[model samples]
Target: MITTKDLQHLFALIAADIAAHRDHLCELDGAIGDGDHGLAMDAGCEASVKAVAALDPAQATPAAAFNTAAKAFLNAVGASSGPLYATAFMRAGAAVKDRPDLSDEEFLRAFAAMAAGIQERGKAEPGEKTMVDAWKPAADAALDAWASGASLLECFDLAERAARQGCEATRDMTAAKGRASRLGERVIGHIDPGAASAAIIIASIAKFVEQHDSCRIDM
Candidate 1:
């Protein structure tokens, strides 16, 4: 089971991983964006982990932790990614509302909800060269792997692979959304910064599950 403490740790791990890749993320954004994605993401993750860390794990439910993270991330990052990630965390909270702790499957459901929320909030499709390219396929792969009776670790592994593939696919796609869209064919050779960041986030999640998972047995 994943307690509030576990969620806090997960958030911290995510922050650390994102921090490590900050420069690369910014470099990716420089091609077609304002080139501050790395900064915004780092700040938001830091705020989110700090907020989650402040919660009393013994008293806080998973929902409360996720909700707190949502508010903190949104407040810290007023950029376009802010609302998207805020919604994602909010949806994750709602998915497991009132749960004292999360089972592996419950955590997986919350993750899927995050992807759904981002897709809905951004109104972007899979081929739009947005974060949806990574998030959607990753979520789908995780759910599918779980449904197929894979272990939690295996499911996350598949999700990370899917996210990476989706991120790479964006390099061949013309941007259909965001500022990059205005560039048309010029955006085709470059991966979307949002997709790149999304892939990083998914990779972090997969790593977290692999390292701390208690549900390694096949379902």
Candidate 2:
């Protein structure tokens, strides 16, 4: 079962990745964006970590922990992406509602809801040169791998690969969402900032789950 600890670990991993890739993320944003993606995400995820860490254990259920981070991310982030990402986790937490210890199926439900929420709210899709491009693929892979009776770790692995491939695919897509959409064909060949950040977060989650997972089957 995935506990609050597991969710905390996910936040920590993303925090570390944000630290390591801050400059890179900014560099990517600089290419086709306002060049503030790195700082914006760093602030958001860092605040998310602090929010999770400071959770009053007395009140810290799995759902509450996620909700706290979502709220904190919104409070700390000041970019166009902030509301989008904040909505993702907030929707996920709402999906899980009162659950404290979540099963693999529940985890799927939460994240799948997050993916769908982000897509719907952003009005974007896979290959739209947006975050949904990466997230939609990862979400699809997660569901597919799990339904095929794959181990939880295997499911994450598949999701991670799909997110990465989707990020790369954004490079060839004409931006049809966000600021990139304003550039039209000029957006092609430039990676979308939202897609890149989403890929990093998904990859970080997969890596965390694999390294700290204590119960993944060997299948």
Candidate 3:
């Protein structure tokens, strides 16, 4: 089962990955946006990791960790991504409310709930060249893999792959949402910063799950 400790580690991984890719993400945003997406994401994820790290593992539930991270992220980031990710973590926390640990199925549900929450909060749809492009496909791929009896680690692997593909596909799509939308066809041939960062986050989660098999529970 995945414990609160595992969740804390996952946030740390995300923070690290985001920090490393911050400049790349900003470069992508500069192609069609305000070029601050990376800065916001890096700050938010770092804040989340710090907040989650401060929680007492012996007393914190997975839901509590997620909730704490969400608040910290929202408070740290002023960009649109702030509320989007905060809602995602909030929905994930609700998906496993009162749980100290998560079973494989529970984890999948929470993962999918995060994408759903983001979509609801942002009012964005897939193919809009937003983070939803990465998150929705990743959630769907994970759920499908789980339904086919894959282990949690394999499900995460599939999710990460799907997220990567989704991020790459953004290069061919015009931005139908966000600040880039005003750019129209000029947004094409450039990857969306939000989608790219979403891929990084999913990949980090997959990497963490792979390295920590003890966190996995049976299907």
Backbone clashes under 3 angstroms, per model: 0, 0, 0
lDDT of 3 at 89: 97
Angstrom error of the Cα, residue 208, model 3: value is 1.1
Whole-model lDDT values for every prediction: 0.93, 0.85, 0.94
Write candidate 1's Cα lDDT for 131-173 as tens digits.
9999999999999999999988999999999999999999999
Residue pairs with backbone atoms closer than 3 Å in model 3 (clashes): none
How do the candidates rank by lDDT, highest first? Answer: 3, 1, 2
Stretches of candidate 1 above 4 Å error?
214-219
Model 3 scores a C-alpha lDDT of 0.94
